[model samples]
Target: MNIKVFIYDDNLSRRDSLKALLELSPELEFAGEAINCSAAVQDMETCFPDVVLMDINMPVVDGIEGLKTIKQNFPHIKVLMQTVFDDSDKIFECIKNGASGYILKKDPPQRILQAIQEVYEGGAVMNPSIALKVLEYFKPQEQKSPLSEREQQVLQLLAQGLSYKMVADKLFLSFHTVNSHAKRIYEKLHVSSLGEAIAYYYKNLHQ
Candidate 1:
């Protein structure tokens, strides 16, 4: 079945160009178009499109507000944000507001069509440059686990429901050695019990 697409952009030329591009694809149907998203709720109700191509920087009602309005009123519909700017703040805003994909307006027509189909089929799409920026934003937020490799091994065995004796037998270590490792693991993780240590392993250390 062809996926129906709607457009929300203030530029007549851009909207027209997009409509023409959609017509080139046998798998896509151009449901409708709009000047801006000031009447986003009503416009969405009228089109009921499977996907929306939203220009991110309209004059009055920008794409971020329109994206939020669409998601609130019609959570099932997928919205794809298109913009000339690679502004990280707006990219984050659209994502937070439930945009299914983000792409540059300068992207090739084929990429845009592919993005529309992808979002319709329940996949999130991002332009490669945009994806790199997203990765860069989160790079500094990843925390390194402080547990040593051997301690992590002990924790992994414990997480797999092994007792201290069983862990010692598997690793060919003394039971006291496994017990001592368990105590150090708990101290390093700031967890008190075996269950707590196992939970921390799953939450932060297990990889």
Candidate 2:
């Protein structure tokens, strides 16, 4: 079955282009398109999309709030955010709020298609430039990895965009134990949020 994609971008040209692109791809179907996400929930509920192509910067309701609403209501639907530039703060916010992927507006068509597929298949994707910005956004104050071997393993999985539960299952550890290691990792890294922790992982621990 083709993955259904809904677009939420204010740019008419971009929306049109995306619609045309979707028509060309056998793996994707254009469920619907919207001007903005002001009615994010209603739109998603109506369109019944498997993945959403969300524009991060919209006029009335930007992707951030729309992402929040969708994740809150329809946790299974994947969202892939696109922006004209690598806005690190927005990127951090989106990731923290459960955005499945982030990509540049200027990225080639093939990459965008690949991102949608990857996210639909439960993998997190980030533009390389955006990934670099995410690391620089939270430049660790310390380089030393205070994390134990288990903590490092947990963090590495998290960095790959695995959820805590997924990491626990992959490592054959209880979910509560994984949570404990995550908490310890945060305390040791002097970071307090998921986005910051992932950034710290890339900055300090990622090989």
Alpha-carbon RMSD of each model: 6.3, 16.3
Number of clashes in every candidate structure? 0, 0
Q: What lDDT does candidate 2 reach at residue 65?
A: 91
lDDT of 1 at 154: 88
Error of 2 at 101 (Å): 0.8
Q: Give stretches of model 1 more than 4 Å off.
A: 141-207
Off by over 4 Å in 2: 143-207
- The best candidate in terms of TM-score: 1
lDDT of 2 by residue, 18-84 (tens): 9999999999999998888888889987989999999988998888999999999999999999999
TM-score of 1: 0.68
lDDT of 1 by residue, 70-115 (tens): 9999999999999999899999989988999999999999899999
